[model samples]
Target: MVAAYPDDVDTLVAHEPPINAVLPDAAGAARARAGFYEAYQAKGTGAGMAAFIAMTSWQGEFTDEYFAQPAPDPAMFGMPTEDDGTRDDPLLSQRSWAVTDYLPDAARLLAAPTRVVVAVGEESAGTYTARTAVGMAGLLGREAVVFPSHHGGFLGGDFGYAGKPAEFATRLREVLAD
Candidate 1:
């Protein structure tokens, strides 16, 4: 939006967008992503979620060691081990791969009037999205603005992953005000 309709916005707070193209080992990352998708297709939601967790929780670059790890067990994460034989999951499937594969147009965004503030959670340091946030900010000749919590910081307890929503909101207000 900032690149296309630059005049329609002022401050664009992009919070921890998981653009794998921004990573150093983008090909490795894509491979790792495909591994999880494969897990989903082979197993079920449980195995897929387990693999997804492993992928997301992995720190630093996607090294050979990352792939050498054993396949995650669904029961380990308290998930079902049964294969329901369904593959329409939005997150586990390749449906959202385009979003992660997106390579941001830095020059176009910089030329725009919008102030793009790439944000990452303080607790998400060293994570994939955090690194991408930093990389995205670097592409814009700036540093990533630290947010209050994790990736889903703004979310409430309804999602079972509660974060500092109040503090996150306050920080967001401060960032937008600036």
Candidate 2:
């Protein structure tokens, strides 16, 4: 039940040929055409073509709407960093990009869920994954809550699951129960 980008899911399940490689085929072409129509209607020809190009090229970028407002305090969040101290790992970067790429689909799933909560480790804001989680939560009309670490700091290098799983679980249970 974990929702993710079509491409990310492909990565997880090891889909061959990748989803982007098939867009020019019959069904994909039709869908693309329809998508262009919709985009043009909403945003005009130039923006629509831009979107279409981004879609086909797998170069979709994240926007503020993909994140929540009054974002979790940055001081408390810490995204995963490379050994060189850069917050850019290939997989994590892809996850972030995929989240942005498939936002419309994710929004649909969020709308259908009876209950949804977006959680991010206080340490990942501004990073791709954190931003994705924030964006997804915003689309779903859910609040993004940052749980404190064992040391009471907000940031950790782990993917929002660092420091005291039990406490975090308990907090999550409480939130869900409410």
Candidate 3:
């Protein structure tokens, strides 16, 4: 974004971005992120996905105790236990780490001719992504605007992880309108 539109822009709405550019707990977050990869390497896709799920759903700060905890069963989260013979779990796979570890150019953003609105879900308060959103906004000297539902708030489907997309859109429109 900084490269493409550094001189001309209006508003940027970042929703639950894994931004650690100015996070106070950057090192801790990095360690916690490494734990997911460790789980994948040490165990298997199932265990790694489980750890990834736990990491994203975590309520508070990542700690040593969090890393020391056992991985939960994938079945509990509707994940199959049978060896699917597939390593592409998408979000939990190795390819996603670079995106997660991406640190935005804070200086470029701060000096940009754009208004940035950091957003997080109300239902996602205290979770890892929510914290990141808040942290990113703090770096911009603003507060994260809470939307109506969880991370998938923009999605409306009966996919078991459904969120209030209508209300989320309403809130998002409100934020963008500002």
Which run of 10 residues does model 1 get worst, by summed lDDT?
155-164
Model 1, range 110-172, lDDT digits (tens) per residue?
A: 999998999999999988888889888888899999999899999999886788999999999
Ranking of all candidate structures by their TM-score, best first = 1, 3, 2
**Candidate 3: which pairs clash?**
none
List residue ranges in candidate 1 displaced over 4 A: none
The list of candidate 3 runs beyond 4 A from truth reads: 41-44
Rank by lDDT (best first): 1, 3, 2
C-alpha lDDT score of every prediction, in listed order: 0.90, 0.39, 0.79
Error of 1 at 59 (Å): 1.0
Q: In terms of lDDT, which candidate is stronger, 1 or 3?
A: 1
Ten-residue region with minimum lDDT total, candidate 3: 81-90
Q: Kindly list the per-residue Cα lDDT of model 2 for residues 121-164, writing each as its tens digit.
A: 55444433344445555555655666434322332456453465
TM-score of 2: 0.36
Q: In the order shown, what is each candidate's alpha-carbon RMSD?
A: 1.2, 15.1, 2.0
Quality of model 2 by C-alpha lDDT:
0.39
Q: What is the TM-score of each candidate against the true structure?
A: 0.95, 0.36, 0.88
